[model samples]
Target: MGTVFLAHHLSTDPSALSPFALKVVDKSLSFAADADRRARWEISVLSRFRLHDPLHPFLPSLLGSSENADILCWAVPYCPGGDLNVLRHRQNDSVFSPSVIRFYLAEIILALQHLHGLGIVYRDLKPENILIQQSGHVTLTDFDLSRSLTPKKLDPDPLHVACSEPETDSDLSRTFTRFVCPRKKKNVNNQKGLRKAKSARVSPVSRRNPGSFYERSNSFVGTEEYVAPEVVRGDGHEFSVDWWALGVLCYEMLYGKTPFRGKNRKDTFKRILMMQPEFMGKQPNALTDLIGKLLEKDPTRRLGYRRGASEIKEHEFFRGLRWDLLTEVVRPPFLPSKDETELTEEVKKGGIDIRDYFDKLKAPSSPLWSPSLDEQRHNVSLTEF
Candidate 1:
């Protein structure tokens, strides 16, 4: 447990406390957004465990959180280890046991099922987002782009619905606030940022009672790379986007890259719009079949029938899974031996390296330098903190 503590929700005022991790909001503006909105965003996450809690074996449990300045942060149980994506990059990564991979994939399916059940769709499902705990537990993180699997609220406040996509500074700040909230010197730009953020949130979209909500005027947002087809065409999106991302993440995990690789903004969107991704010798037939169904352009036939938890658990790839006996299911099949490195020393020191990596990714650069990440990746290392 964190020496200090806060609420399970990342947005709230619980006194000035430090807990699970000492994350810093990269920008001061986002850190100041209203707490109730943050609470709602995180509720989508915490409520998800009704399908997979301690019994699920893979997902992480919510520990707690605290308020530091205007930001409310969660104390997610620290997974004192590394993520599968990091493991894959190492030369010894080839040593990853097949059984562990199976366990990871199995749990992912269950997670998807649980989210789908509640009508929640996790739009960004990457290997890096899945945490591997010291006890071999796998907790999913970064549901920031996740959409409601059920009916979306009729009139969500645009102020609270921000994300890092759709090219809005507010979205970037919203992500920045929670992802980066534990710095001293980093606050250099914060004073001005907080002013700008406050204006954005307070500038009334309408004069109809400041506290009341009406229809949102903002576009739905997501990282361009992981965004789904229906979303790009302005045709409207749903839980299907999550499945598409899941396919992309799964492909990248096994093949070492996304199936459709484009460096140009128009080209990437065009590729998604018209081209068929080359499976090459990249993955096995079962894997290919699974991705093909997900990447289909048509939202209806795509994703197969949105199945229940039992049906998802019984998919061909997920064979041998005992739905009712989930607790008996083994940990992800391919764990790297729990070396000394597996128990992260950072956690012992009251911090986690997750924010370090994401912080290195940095809050979105100013609108002045705004460029597609693909273009930026060629010229700059995004991971440089």
Candidate 2:
């Protein structure tokens, strides 16, 4: 839908920061309307974050934006450490330790909480979208798939059931029975064996009446592997979907792969609806226990469904964590080197003009095409931060 460039802000003020990531969406593209809508929504969401008194530390701050006859563009601070996926690949086992996961997950939870406070549901929450700032702390990116919905009011007697006894098979079956067809009752007898059977089908259940305090979005948008079961069923989903994705993210960090990924999207969706996460250890631990509750197939029973982030923060996995001192930790799991933060000589010398570059693409095919131009264009495409 767009291209991102490592750009320098040319300004006379000495206080101005120069290096930033410039995202450009060409208005002439075939999906211009959709691209334009996403870009505008992202900018609007970031703008609201910038208005907060202390400004959310973990949410992206919009530097600026502009639109022309042919393109729409916006700028955000560049994260020199790349994204969590890149950082994880750098690890020896392509996975993070328990301590590392806790630190990063804490910051991510805070960011998601802030978005929920503003009535926004962040539909995207995979490792690729969690960028590592220069300080090594995580910040969420890519708000294009996000939507605004009224958050559910906190229940007066919230169910603090995350650490309660695990749900029995009967309980689980009852939670999902309404979504499965009555004719498929025979399949319920073999709940343990359904993981291997590809014939079973669970249809989506539409909500008859949505609550007045909260609005649900039926838009089916999210990365296939990280999507919630509710989303896969096309049932209207709310903020709990993020919690489900968080569980997927946590599982991947510990096990080096997603819990229920199948051979194809169809099989994957089937696994999401039926299969349970397979933990490696012999006994239950705080981390795995937390992931289990967060991955609850019923949105109403998910860990953060009732009281939001507060419930997760109070879990054993995050016990003794000084939430207020996260930013002051001084040492995160990974930090970018000087090379990663330094601007190239070419970038320092005013870099490429984005608008002018797009104009060249529209020019006649005479003497303008060259190997160097092609190389530069490739570089621009690969430099998204």
Candidate 3:
């Protein structure tokens, strides 16, 4: 929806001094209206997360923002390790081991849980949107597609009760006291590798299912391959859609591809509505079983539909996981090296001005129309999709 630039912020206050990903959109563009709205919505969501005493570790913190007659801009902490998709591509088989997937998925679930508690539905949940922080932990990004809906009130259940106090050190430690690592299994079919393919992003579908649940969004949004079946059927969706996408993500991490991808978007949506996820192993393991439940076509039958993330957390696949000690893990699946974290001399002195870069783009006839020095050095450019 907007372009992202790697820029350095210089300030007298040490706390404000750091490199940030500056996302900017030219207000003069034809599509700027919708993009502007999405940007503001995303900022609002991040600001809401900050209201908590200690912000959710897996969520982004809005650093600053700016606006003018021609452009709008906002800054977020820069992730040096890129995103999960890039990290997965770097792996030998372009897939993660079960342990690595478990670690990342645990953090992601907590993030989603916090969001659900606040009535937010993270419609988009894919590897590209999962960024690895400098600390080697995962933080979700791209909240533009996220929607806020009122949660349904159900009969009293212990699993549905919300935590009264913030998670204290003792509370977290207690939760992890019985943690145990899962045993690894060897994949027999390693020779047949899957090719990297981009998922389709289609315009919102027009159909709507009025018979669907009350707290549901009828808007057809999300990447095609990761989209939920209810969304494809225009049957409305809520928090369960995120779980469905999570299943797609987990399957992709294990098998190197999405479960329902077909030759085209039509065929893809058809498969999503009709087919079951295929597994490589003959026997059903905890991980496969978890994916199967999460990928359930019926939103009501989905694993996280009723109790939200709590239902997913109770699955055998995540048994004995130290939910609270996730941040304490000294080593994660992957960490950015010293070289990746280093900034160029030019960036150290003073990064390029985002406003000036957009101004140059406005003047097509100017010499700056060609790739500028900053573009060559930092690869800064406008991203529209």
Candidate 4:
């Protein structure tokens, strides 16, 4: 769960707004130990590219992030529109119309296009992690695990690449951290944070859950339910991890539950690594076939590896989608609304920048308002005094 801060107000009532949802990684968690700080810095570093990327439903446009940004630890646009995960859970899931799924797919494709063009691999892609804006746009968010592949490729020596799996222990950390040293160590020049986090062979999962462990306890990234097979088996991991996750998400969306789930972690990875996904109980054949291809154990066989997002969209399931028309399309399938007046008043108390996020978009082709690079660097200092 994340701290609920009001990021902005909806356009329906320009006078008021809704809350922004931002999840801060707990310092106690290995991933978030420095992830919050890293996310903002990464954006700042990539602001040049971010400024040029088109505003679309698939990516939640970053507003601003700060060290002590209240209500939410990380600032993002307020999206009262919720997401597919909430919609399916609260209401019900059914065969989405071609219009609905196609439109959403376009947004997803566009998002991937931008990220991939920049050579940024978003390793985590899931419904729960996505954001559907108040304006009915879908955005892929939670880029904390994203990495730049092009930069790493520049190293002339193969030594720069991660080493092969170790034989001493089943875990990879024990064998690697000694030499693998984090990528951020040189960038941030933060040897201190690096050393503390590196002092681990295996980080015990949080105490809240007795058996809790790293997302891919095998390698130390995403959650167990969504971790990629390559990561679990100690195969070299890369940006493609996100594509693998996208497959998992597509599977979960069509079915109400994850493709590979178990009572415990060991059993879970066993299913992911060995078992094949099946179309269970009255599911669409088209959806099932898509997932079967998606949940392939080998990353090379998975969707979006060689051919890219267009290829994934062109899969038989999306045969009818007009890729050209998708970029400009609007009006998603189901748009939920509460009492406009009540929501507006509630938003006034919801601490987000209502005008900046919701009303500020000038056109679909052009976003007139975004956090200026200067403002993003030097956060606003408010006074409650």
Among residues 3 or more apart in sequence or in different chains, the pairs in candidate 3 whose N, CA or C atoms overlap within 3 Å are: none
TM-score of each candidate structure, all chains considered together? 0.59, 0.80, 0.80, 0.64
lDDT of 1 by residue, 20-139 (tens): 322223223333343335454764476455344343445444554445433444545545445767766763533333345456666676666556555556666777778766555566
Predictions in order: lDDT: 0.46, 0.74, 0.75, 0.52
RMSD of each: 15.9, 9.3, 10.2, 13.9
> Which window of ten consecutive residues has the lowest lDDT sum in model 1?
171-180
Error of 4 at 156 (Å): 12
Instruction: Return the candidate ranking by TM-score, descending.
Output: 3, 2, 4, 1
Give me the candidate number with maximum lDDT.
3
lDDT of 3 by residue, 171-218 (tens): 321121111112332222221222212342234332333221225676
lDDT of 2 by residue, 194-308 (tens): 1222332455332222232366777778898998887776556788999999999999999899998999888888889888999986279999999999999888678988667
TM-score (C-alpha) between model 3 and the true structure: 0.80
Query: Against the hidden true structure, what lDDT does model 2 obtain?
Result: 0.74
lDDT tens digits, residue span 151-255, model 4: 322234433434233323111111211123223323211112111112122322221211100111223567788877666655445545777777677767666
Clashes of each: 21, 0, 0, 13
lDDT of 4: 0.52
